[model samples]
Target: MDFFELVNRRESVRGYLDKPVEREKIEKIIEAGRVAPSACNAQPWKFVVVNDKAIVSQVARKLYDPLISGINKFALTSPVFIVVVAESRNLASKMGKLVKKKDYTNIDIGGACENICLAATELGLGTCIMGWFKEKGIKNILSIPSNKEVTLVISLGYYEDKEPRKKVRKDIKEIMSYNNY
Candidate 1:
């Protein structure tokens, strides 16, 4: 698909089919993320792709709240969970963050995550980048080091619903300016 069409097609898929995503497709999605540009080329990101049903269930447990109805319940049905981890920043990225007063790690990881989602969309798969999850639980389950942090969890699979949802967004005129805001 064209870039514009891919962008339009990409959405947060909450429901997924029972079928598992192919490993080859998953690897390509990860490759896309791996090549994503980072601040100062500081690719401080690690991805844990959980395909095992048992491990996926364990990861999904961190996203659910039995007491709260409809709280990330859709995650349970996803066939794969890609845990995005933010590793410790290198010296250059650290200095850049301090000088610019910006969280470069978060920004870099965001780009990588976007790449993962876009790649998945291109591969005829669906993805949902989830921020609402138990970070500590996930880190423990994945055996992530204490220094590195769990950035986000992307649920991946085939969309259960065939209908396409319309995209809602601000117009270019409203969101863009010629030279200045």
Candidate 2:
């Protein structure tokens, strides 16, 4: 499918089949993230692919409610879970010797996450990007280093159910402007 069609078709998938995601496919998704542009080329993202049922259950248990409730359920049934981490301090260091903030790393990682999501859609797989979770618990569960910040969790699998219809959005004329609002 074309990029625009893929973007239109991509939706947050909350249900998954029992089949395992192929390792090759997972690698392709990861590669998409790896190649995403970053501020100053810091490339501060690291992805942890989790397929073990035990880990998935643990993650589901720690995920926050309502926003992530559907994702938690999907995690339990999905074949893969990828945790996106950002090396905040390391990225800042690369920015300059006198850097004082870490917010840019989040932007860099968010782009990477979006790339992974789009790549999954193109691969005929479903994905849901999750940010509502106990970061400390997930860090420990995934054996992430102290310096790495957990940015998002993505659930991946073969979709077993259809996605809900796309919600209506404001027209571009209402939301966009040629100059300052």
Candidate 3:
């Protein structure tokens, strides 16, 4: 698929088929994230792919909004999830962060997460990048170290609905300014 088309087609899929995602495709998705660039070559990201049915359920349990009911309930239909973990940046990146007064770790992780999603879209898998999950619950379920941050959880699988939903967005002219804000 064309890159533009792929980007447009990639949506936060809330529903997925019952079929399992292939392991090869999952690996390819992670490979895309692995090759993503980060500040000072920090590469501060780890992807925990959870394709096991039992674990997927456990993770799903943590996705709903406790303050409300039925929010993120669609996650129950997802067959797989790739948990994006934020790792420590390299010394150079850390110094840069200090000097620039900006933390690049989360920014770097965002790029990697996008890469993972785009790769999945290219390989005929649907994905939803979730930030509304319970981070502590995910850490415990995945055996992730307490120090590591669960930045995002991505639901992945074949879409139950193959049709692409039209994307709503701010107009280009409103969003872009070439030389001035």
Tens-digit lDDT string for candidate 2 (4-114):
988887788877888888899999999999999887778877899998887877876666455643536555666788988886545445656356444567878888988
* Clashes (N, CA, C under 3 Å) per candidate: 0, 0, 0
Q: Model 1 off-target regions past 4 Å?
A: 161-163
lDDT digits (tens) for residues 1-181 of candidate 1: 9999898889999889999899999999999999999988999999999999999999999987676785889999999999999887888988988999997888899999999999999998999999889888998988898777898999999985565589788898999999898
Best by lDDT: 1
Q: Sort by lDDT, best first: what order?
A: 1, 3, 2
Instruction: Compare the candidates by TM-score and give the number of the best one.
Output: 3
For residues 15-46, what per-residue lDDT tens digits would candidate 3 score against the true structure? 88999999999999999999999999899988
TM-score of each: 0.94, 0.85, 0.95
lDDT at position 168, candidate 3: 95
Model 1 / residue 23 / CA error / Å: 1.1
- The segments of candidate 2 whose C-alpha lies over 4 angstroms from its true place after superposition are 64-71, 89-102, 161-164
